[model samples]
Target: MARTPSAMKYHRQSEKRRLDNRARKSTIRTFTKKALAAADSGDVDAAAKYQKVVQGLVDRAAKGSTLHKNTAARRKARLAKRINAAKASQGSA
Candidate 1:
């Protein structure tokens, strides 16, 4: 319900940005899930590779404002920890 021309334009821009942000966030989540699945399956090498990809995606999302910087860092840390733990368990067994 934007009455003014500028307001209407702004609304359109915002809608586009919203869709783009949602897509980026979805992609980040998918990468994170893939990394975790690899870790859970005890494929340390594959998990590490996926974790690197996830880290890059998260960093890009944070830089672009799709995700908070701290949130991205925290997620990266958690993923790395999980990967390390998987590696440790694999080594011990």
Candidate 2:
């Protein structure tokens, strides 16, 4: 439905960006799960490591405009809180 060449090009670019952003979000979710799993299993070290990785990824995604800055910050905060709670509840946070 894009009649103009410029419009067609813009559509292609948007489609590509959509796929890339989707993949980026999926990766963030995967790492988040890993971090949560590590925390639930009481592995403080692994949880912290994965948390760091997720934070970096989220930051990058936000910087690249794939995620909003506030959303990224909120996610990082919630994940850290969950990890901390999991560790503390394990008796040696």
Candidate 3:
């Protein structure tokens, strides 16, 4: 559909960027899920490890513009809250 040479090049570049962004987004989801599962399992050490990974993923996603900064922040906050709650509940038990 891109008749112009420049337009074709731009299309190719955009597709590549889209693929890269998709990969980053997927990675973020996976990291968040791992962190959540660790928290749910009430394993403090594993939760901590996954939390760090999730934080890094969120930062990378925000930096790359694959995710909005505020969205990333919100997700990170929720994940931390869950981890903390799990930790507290385990301590009480």
lDDT of 2: 0.96
The number of the candidate with the highest TM-score is 1
Candidate lDDT scores, in order, read: 0.93, 0.96, 0.89
Model 1, 2-93: lDDT tens digits are: 99999999999999999999999999889889999999998889899999999999999899878999999999999999999999999999
Question: For residues 1-93, could you state the per-residue lDDT of candidate 2 as single tens digits?
Answer: 898999999999999999999999999999999999999999989999999999999999999989999999999999999998988898853
In model 1, residue pairs whose N, Cα or C atoms come closer than 3 Å (at least 3 residues apart or on different chains), thus clashing, are none
**What TM-score number comes out for model 1?**
0.96
Task: Name the 10 consecutive residues with the lowest summed lDDT in model 3.
Answer: 35-44
Error of 3 at 29 (Å): 0.8
User: Is 1 or 3 the stronger prediction by TM-score?
Assistant: 1
RMSD of each: 0.7, 1.3, 0.9
Error of 1 at 51 (Å): 0.4
Model 2 residue 42 distance off true place after TM-score fit, in angstroms = 0.9
lDDT string for model 3 (1-93, tens) is 898999999999999999999988888789778888888887888988988988998898898778899999999999899999999999999
Give stretches of model 1 more than 4 Å off. Answer: none
Question: Between 1 and 2, whose TM-score is larger?
Answer: 1
